[model samples]
Target: MFKNIVRNIFLEAENANVKKYVKQISGADKLDPIIVIKPNPTWVANYGWIAYNNAMDQFAIYNLNNNQRRDKNSRCIFHFRDIQELHTVQDGICNRNLIPNGFHVPQGLQANIALGTNNPVPIGRAYLVINLEIKKLEFLEDKKFFYVD
Candidate 1:
């Protein structure tokens, strides 16, 4: 299911700059990296989520730019705290705008979230899953930014 979604996203999009960045992050041979969400080893998985969230935030910035282009009278300054906040806010806005009643996922996905809930486990578990699609990785070939000097 995840693979299908990723494939769809890739097929339905075209972003040259983003593709270049991903290629730089991952090796040339490895075009699409499957990042799994795990409990242990905090850095890798968390960083993956952060990157995905950042990409979404970039999309929000594009949207804001579009709004500015469309409406001359509307002046809105949007500030985002990292990509995670942008993703959360964008998801909320999308749900509110698209869905009449609101969006609801199956219980299994969010059942573990219980930080403030009146349940046995007072502390909640933080977890995330994200899939990124790269159109092309050619820009990484000549880029030294991703390398450790």
Candidate 2:
């Protein structure tokens, strides 16, 4: 599930000091970063997209800025070792219900929707809020994952 499912949650940070934040993430031992997944009321109110999951226990990062890593806004990508680390450090409940009314499913995830099944595998987006410090995240500038389409 970890390998193929949820990978990177693109955080769009505006007016934030990225260098300082990076230093805090790398230097401080007690820096517990809380990553808010979509379907988050606060996030939806402020930004406007609810990333809902369809499968139980399926956790994935919510892309906040919708991949617009531009205009003094930087994207923070946290690389986890595995699923265990993700589960151990995470500190929130994931809504496993299918995407509710009024939520726009991004074009990137349209292909992930299951075609025909009452119980579909978790091929769509996942919503999770995680603590980065406990997971011992590593910051990689050039690290990228490839998908076979």
Candidate 3:
């Protein structure tokens, strides 16, 4: 489950920074992503690791960011989708979960409904997939607005 799944995940990150780094090293982007027993997230950008996975806690949970070299040190190349398989059912809520009960999604984003997906591992949890930089992760309060597809 681990090896095959990770191999597939790496394939999904074909555009990962390691590929670009390897290309710059010796013109080869084929260096397979190395998986350490337990990786330190802070050391990721410094060591140029394509991905660094910290172990899951009691509930067995983790998250990943997109592929980008945001700072001068470590470039984050994590994708939250590939590793975790979200199997929650959206009963017309995820489409507009961010809006107030009486409100609705804007007409412009209505056509893009096909782009949304369910929450993470557990079902019925309100994991807002917003479009802003969240300094810290916290549960959404009632009647508040957030950006979601």
Candidate 4:
């Protein structure tokens, strides 16, 4: 199901840059990466604050701000700390204008994550699952960033 969505995005995306990025990442040998996302205020307001171990695997998320060419249904990501600050803002504003942040897999767990062998690295509020063999990007869940014990 999720694979089809990403496949459609790769095939039907209007943005040239997005297509190019998809090509690059899809074909790359390494997919050890992190998906950076700010808190979704709507989700929090409706469902209360985000908690650790919460699965945030929402594919085909709507683009709230479609102001840029690269803002083509991408995830919420700006600076690294936006994950922490997103839950604190009272205003409706969010990290919709920034580029998506995904980084290379660390050396230690690259094999485990790539192979999907009980590799659950703590990435702040991000839960990212990447299977390079199938060229699939799966989101795990989000966790509470601030005000946690």
Candidate 5:
């Protein structure tokens, strides 16, 4: 439910750049990335918060869990011109920690998150997945900033 709402808000955002990146990376020129966000459903999983942060930057993740490796999905990132992205990825994937995983945060998405009654024990260390390609990584920053609303 949250994803849908966020997606819709992004679609309507102004002074932001989500729509631009969608056209550049998606290569469809039809606003596909705006709705699908790179066509990856299971986008970005995390055992804890480590890979969750890394997926947004350029520290390309390698499945830490063996059995559930196949379940990993593309980490849906909200690339924006926030204070964090300004420093790191300045050259390309610099920071290794979020302090509080700062990059994963955009428009204060972290604040909106609620521990749904069932925060189950992690089944594996499959922390984070994303559909970004190594080549298009630099293009992330070019997108306009988007707020969750």
Candidate 6:
């Protein structure tokens, strides 16, 4: 069925070699700031994005170059109180932002500015993972790339 095909794609996308290549291209030591969500009950997905928060303190901050704080106010800021705010914002804007096919970029992948700062301008990516359990005889085809910048 279609579920099988999707599962195969996901498997290939997350293979060992693919992960190694992604790591090299992204230059990320570790995959942090990973978001896992269960949007449905049939399939699970995994995504990777850049982390902007201090790993030790678990605090998120805007990566800026200078002292200018004007842009900081306009860009999305994340805090303990803004968890849901971030999720909602991401859900709302996930579909509009899609990365063009090039280099190691895979199909059905997207990116957006999850958070920003005024100083140097933030340059990072975010990741997402989904888990689903399929049951019964069903044909689920609702697939779209979702992520926050």
**Model 6 C-alpha lDDT per residue in residues 2-52, reported as the tens digit of each score:** 234334334444455444433332321122122312121111111212221
TM per prediction: 0.21, 0.24, 0.16, 0.26, 0.21, 0.20
The regions of model 3 sitting more than 4 angstroms off are 12-107, 110-147
Using TM-score as the measure, which candidate wins?
4
Model 5 Cα lDDT, one tens digit per residue, 1-149: 22333344354544334544343334422211221122112223423445444443232222223433211233333322233433233223313332222222243444565422122221112111123453332222222221111
For each of the candidates, give the backbone clash count: 0, 0, 1, 3, 14, 15
Sorted by TM-score (best first), the order is 4, 2, 1, 5, 6, 3
Worst 10 residues of 3 by lDDT: 51-60
Looking at model 6, report the run of 10 residues with the lowest lDDT sum. Answer: 39-48
| Model 3 C-alpha lDDT per residue in residues 1-149, reported as the tens digit of each score | 22232233334445464455323222112222211112233334433242222111101222223432211222222112211222121223234342122122345665665534321111111222211222321222122122234
Give the least accurate 10-residue stretch of model 1, judged by summed lDDT. 140-149
Clashing pairs in 3: 45-74
Candidate 4 lDDT tens digits, 69-119: 211334332211232323323111112311111122345646644432221
Give the true-structure RMSD of model 2. Answer: 12.7
lDDT for position 5 in model 6? 32
| Stretches > 4 Å off in candidate 4 | 1-31, 36-39, 42-125, 135-138, 144-147
Best by lDDT: 4
lDDT preference between candidates 5 and 6, better one? 5
Positional deviation of 57 in candidate 5, in angstroms?
Answer: 4.8
- Candidate 4 lands at a TM-score of 0.26
